[model samples]
Target: MTKDEFIQELEVLIRARYGVILINTLEEERALDLLTDLARKLNKRLLTWSCTRGLVMDGNTAVHPDTVDLMTAIAKAEQLAEEPSLFVWLDLQSHLNSSPVYIRRFKELAQEIRERMPSNSIIVGPLMEIPTELQKEVTIIDMPYPDLNELKMIISQFAQQYRDRNDLQIDCSESALDALGRASIGLSKTEIENCLAKSLVQHKRITGEDIDFILEEKKQNIRKSGILEYVDTEKLETADIGGLDNLKKWLEIRKKAYTPEAEQFGIGWPKGVLLVGVPGCGKSLSAKCVAASWKMPLLRLDLGRVFGMYVGSSEANIRLALSMSEAVSPSILWIDEIEKALSGLASSNQSDGGTTSRVFGTILTWMQEKKSPVFVFATANNIGSLPPELLRKGRFDEIFFVDLPNEQERAEIFRIHIKRIGRNPENFDIAKMVKLSGEASLGDGVRLTGSEIEACVNQALLEAFFVRNSEGHPEGDVTSADIERAIVQSVPLSRVRKEDIGYMRTWATDNAVRASLAPESALSSAPESPAMAEVTVGRNIDF
Candidate 1:
């Protein structure tokens, strides 16, 4: 939802006679504009109160300018001098911890508004919490981040207003404006404006080149909190993902889910996915792929850093991190190795007085209840250490088991690594190396994972670096034999922990969706088995 939609929703709440409302937002000017429009629509007066400015009536003038105290402002409103008015309180949440009587007074004011008055009290702040005393009396909602169209308008207006500036140039083409708008997706109104200003001041032009500058701005904001890292996925794309076609097909459908047309069609936002699989598979890479494929900002959330030494500080840090994430919505939040962060949940109370448990609970609650378009891409080595509450149906949209790369996926991985090293796969017999790495060429059913395949490619290059041609000159080109030797000498995770892999595979057979697609040979005919059916959900998106 955008600013206009928020105003319409607020109008409904006011018309229904809701007494007290709490809006958690940092856009004070935007909120004031929304409230002003709401008041005009409802035919009510707009009274804004601040800690320093006291209480002001519909206009800027105040009858009693000394009504700066929160209690004094509430007392004046209780007298109902303005029968139908919106009493907006600013910086009120900061004092909720200083005194308890203030909570009681707010509760009574809510009751009085419902029973004896026609006005409503609005408490606005960057961060807010219900005092538990007025939990039922207060209705809380978040002001959503600006959508694409709103951002486009912000850019258009700025460009027109500053077109005559001699120092800075602007690109007002429709395509360029649309690109700028999409680039500013997760930023606030102020941040978007700041990005354009910075681009002009630093580069002398607001063009496509400012994308990097704008992203740098986002990274600076994320770094201030020290929990989430804004990832740069410029080099990563869906094609870089070797396999997980099952997961790929699922993700491809939701690539455009955040568009306005999708919302108009009543399409629900995708919650998230849990990837539990082999250590060397593409679980982590898939997170980067999804963010790149969706054209959304990627944030790496380090859950371990959320803990603090002070009491309740850990919980507060997690909340702060999540709040920042929501502020940058229509983005992807990647939590790699989630099991390590949540491994202590079972014994959290005995160890640290439930700090981990509380932190975990806060995350789960937000994952389930968040209305923003933050798609969580969490990867775990195994699910044994994860709390059962996290595995419940509502926590994630789907749980995918990313197994070792199959023959086709292994071949793709090899080709990708070879090209990275400036070598041609065709020169190295990738097909033969792919067969040698899998069970096709080996009697034992051994297979290299995506990471192991890349490793084999690197080791082959290392071996080839020392070999000399007939004239004693170095033959730096890798051969198929070098890769085969590396494959034979390597001990993969599948072979090292055979029993553990068996257990995980069995669990996934029943509980999780298979990530890799069936081999091309198997799909030539019909799916003969149920496992193949699950692995090949639908045709992969080739385009």
Candidate 2:
């Protein structure tokens, strides 16, 4: 929900005299600011307390300066003046769960406030660590990160703060402000302020150019999370991804799925897609390319890292990861090789005290019920290990099986790798590699994965690099004989894991959509002759 809607809900609960309200958030300062506003609306004085600083009126002098102990602060709160007030307790969760005496005292204090006057107590912390003893008496609210409107307000305030400074200029046109607002959606008030300050210091002004600074700040924040890894996505364009035409086509159609116009047209946000197939058939690469294709940040989630040794810690980590993903909506959450990460599903009850089972259930439930625009791009190689619940309809928009590249796709994969190394693909004899595919049985199958095709081109380049020319330099040309040799020496996973590939292929026939547009008939088609037998590579080398 939006921040304004959340504030309205909190106001209702406060007016209804909810004895104690527990808010979970990392933005302590922002929460306090919100409480001060709510206090004004309720016509009550705002009082705040911390472990170090006893009780102090909001923006006013301390009420109990000598009371440094937490118990003493609670006693003073219990004896509040007859006037209604809102008591905001900061960082009291650690003791609330550890000390029984403190718990009983806080419960009694809550009862006193509810029975005596319109005053209420609020506990704000980084997590919702409420003890079971007071769960019935306290209302828990999971505060969300700053939304677009809140971010715009933060940007406007920063601009106004520097309006008097003659050295700095703030060009906040409606369009510029909107761009900054959208870019700063996931940042907290303090982060937004700090980012804007840094931008002004570096550029002497705030404009559309400052969005990169905000994104860098987000990367730093995500790194601290530990569960989510930020990817350097500048090099991951859709053009770099080879083959998977059907998958690429599917993604292109939904490029504008998250825009305001789509929503206005009654189109809901696209849920996500699942890629299941053999290893290294462009599944994970496709996951990364989506972020670039969609112009969004990419976050990698490692489920193995989420499982903590302590009780309930694993669940907390998942909550943190998922919450942070939602905070940065219009982003991609890539779960690579998900089957291995979510393994031990059947024996979770017998082994890890059902922790894995609970964690698995939590992820599936979130995938099914999440309303945010964070797209879940999950790739799994071992379909047998995956839970049946994840395979059910609606969990993912569609399940795609990325099989081994067909005849034409293998040639395209070869061309992509050659071009990536700064050599023209037309110089290499790719048709010779395709012809070699028809000559070898390669165990039970001739299909090669995209990775194996890349290896063939790389090996051929190595061969060319070692061959010397008459000028005593390495020969510049990669020949058909070099490619043929590399293709014959390379081994495809389809040869070693024949049964596994066969089962997955059989399953894909009925349960999943194919990732490549090549028809099954195209697999047996003959190769075309190359326009040139070989192109020289030595001249293109910078050395």
Candidate 3:
């Protein structure tokens, strides 16, 4: 549920359970204001709980009381015959875990107050962990990140303030407002307000560029979580990826669902996509490229980072990471090499004494129940190693098996790599290169990625420049020969893990994973079952 809904529900529950209520939040300074408002609404006496400057404010102004100590404050509160009084304990929960005497006294005071006057004690802290003894009496409410409406209201307030000061007129269009709202998602009110103040001061005017700045700030927040890495991909688009046409189409269709227009039309956004197949076949590349293609921010969730040393810290970290991702909706969450990260969970107790299992459970629960538009792009190299719970239908929208690139895809890959290095594909014979790297020989040589190919081209260009200077001849452009030599020298993952690749191909085809390639293309390149050539009298078979 949203933050507002959660708060409203808490308010209702508090009213139902106890005649008097205390509402406090983790927001340090804002907690006082919130509690004051609650006190006014409930017509209750406001009492503060603090050790340093105990009971500083009575209602509005500071009225230092005689009883400032914790025991003294509790005694004063209990002695009062007020029908309803809210005792707001701020930043006191942190001390409860370590101080047993304080916890016992607080519980006894709560029990006694509930019987006499309609009084309730609320504990507020950055992190909440209720002991088993007080869990029955306490009601925990999650204060979620701010929503778009709240963010928009805050931005408009800032804009109006700016216009008032400088006599600057700014008319925010729907698209501009949307950009700002989306950029501010996953940020607290204070954070967004701070960003707006900083942006206005820096740019002298809030424009679309400010929206990008806000997104960068949000990325920094995600990075601080330590579980998710905020990656800035350098213009890597779907076109940059040569293979995975089916997967590309799937992502393209869902990209539109993130727009305001789609929301108006009541179109539900796609949850996620699972890429499972052999390694080095653009699975991970597709994950990164999809984020770029959608024009959304990319957050790489390293599952390994979620496991913490503390008992419950791992689960808490997972929740925080997922919460942050949801706050930044319409974003791509790439979990690269997922199988390896989760493999330990299969024998969790034997491996890490059930910590891995608990972490895995937390992740699985989030994936299933999450309502955010954070598109999960999970890539698994070994499907067998992945837990069966992850392979279930509802976990991801569709499971796609990305096989080795076909001849057409291979040619596109070559072109993409060549152009990436500032060399036109027209400068080289791409068709001949494809033929030379066909099925049998290509398995080893042509398995080079766009990145590896670019590196080879760079090396070849250096070699060509040196040769021209030494021989006193014109510098020649890098030819297919250079790429061929690089291919021969470099070993591809396909060559090293041939058996593994073959096994994956057979598994994908047998299990009916939606093939990322065309049917004819898949049939032609049967890496699992190679076709044997028959000899004829007049005809010859070529390898």
Candidate 4:
């Protein structure tokens, strides 16, 4: 429950349990006034405790005493009381652990007072951990962050107040109000008010941009909580990616769901997509590119960071991080190489004595119950390492298997890299380059990732300039020869993980995962066994 709801419930509980009441909050003076008003309604003597003066404010005026012993003071006040009422206030809990005698005496006095008269004692502090013996008698409640409606009210109040002073002429449009309201979702009342005031001062008028700026500022506070890191991507786009047409199409369809128009049409926000595939086939790149395309903030979750050394701290950290992600709605949460992080959880009992298992449980619960618009995009290279619970449908919208780029995709990869390095494709013989590259041994061709191809082109360009200036080479343009030389020199991830890639391809074909590439086309292009007759398909299409 939110802070207001918690307070309202407390008020009702206080009234129903006993006619007398007491409240304690961070704002001590405000708490005193609220309790005093409740005391007036019951027509009972109200008592407060001051650490230095001892037993002050007995309904009418402040009372001073020479002794500061709270238990003794409470006893003396009860003895001198004119009306049959209870004492309620704060500031005695800190010294409870220091003095065992005082704690025992206070508990006995509290029990006796409650039994004899219609009296109740309520103690409040910043962080309260009640002793096990008194746990039954005390109620602990957590004050939650402000919700949308409360935030809207706060924005409205600020706009109205600002408009009244200095003829500010503030126009509180519904869109602007909504933006501000959402921006303040996870902030405290004081924090929201402060941010609103600062935003007004910075922009001169609160616009959507100002609202975004305020939300970015609030994101810093979320980061300070130490659960989630605010990630800033370096302009990675779908165009920079070479293949994964199915994955791209899937993402394009969901892009509209983030807009206000989709909400008007009653379309639910997209949850996220899971990319599971062979290593270096653009799974991680796709995660970053999706966030870039959606124009939302991206947060990278390093699972290792969530596992703490202290017991129970790891679980708490995970909850806090998930809470922050929810607070910053309409954002992308990227968990790269998830298999490595969660692999230990499969046999956590044998591994770390159940710490990993507990952490896994916490994440599973959050993934299922989370209501926030934070799209969770997790990429896994090793499917065998992933727990079966994560593959379930409700956890992610879809699971896409990114296999090795096909012949068509390989040509696209070449063109993308050539253009990226400011080389005119028409000037170079792309067809020969594609033919030479595709004809290479399966191990050589499959070794190339989108990133590796880009690196090859870059190296080729540097060689081209060197040959033209120093060697006075006859070849004016960067040819297939240059690219071939670079490819041979470079070692790709596929070469290093050949066995793993073969396993992934077999798994994709047999398993339930949807291929990110065209199924029929991929099957046709795949190499045939030596036993099969040599077959040739249609005319050659090159880059």
Which 10-residue window of candidate 2 scores lowest in summed lDDT? 532-541
The TM-score values for the models, in the order shown, are 0.77, 0.93, 0.88, 0.75
Clashes (backbone N, CA, C under 3 Å), per candidate, total 0, 0, 0, 0
Alpha-carbon runs more than 4 Å astray in model 2: 164-166, 437-444, 466-471, 474-480, 519-543
Rank by TM-score, descending? 2, 3, 1, 4
Candidate no. 3 TM-score: 0.88
lDDT tens readout by residue for model 4, 219-303:
6776786766776655678897776776787788888887889989998877777788766667887877888888777888888
Q: Model 3: which residue pairs collide?
A: none
How much is 77 displaced in model 3, in angstroms? 3.9
Per-prediction CA RMSD (Å): 5.4, 6.4, 5.5, 6.5
> Which portions of model 3 show Cα errors greater than 4 Å?
18-26, 29-32, 58-72, 80-83, 167-178, 207-209, 264-266, 442-455, 465-476, 512-515, 519-543
lDDT of 1 at 424: 83
- In terms of TM-score, the best-performing candidate is 2
In order, the Cα lDDT scores of the candidates are: 0.80, 0.80, 0.69, 0.67
Summarize candidate 1's per-residue lDDT along 1-543 as a digit string, tens digits.
666777777788887778888887888877787788788978888988888888888759784876888788788878863489888988887766679977877778888887778888888776565677878888877787677788888888888877788877878888888888877776777888888888877888877667877677778889987999988787888888887878898888877687889999999888999999888888888898788878788889999899999987898889888877877777888989999999888899999999999999999999999988889899988768878888889989888888767667877888888888997888878777876776555434346788988898888887777665544756356778888899888877676776676667777876788787776775566323333333343223343
Model 4 misplaced regions, further than 4 Å: 1-142, 164-169, 200-203, 256-271, 418-445, 461-482, 519-543
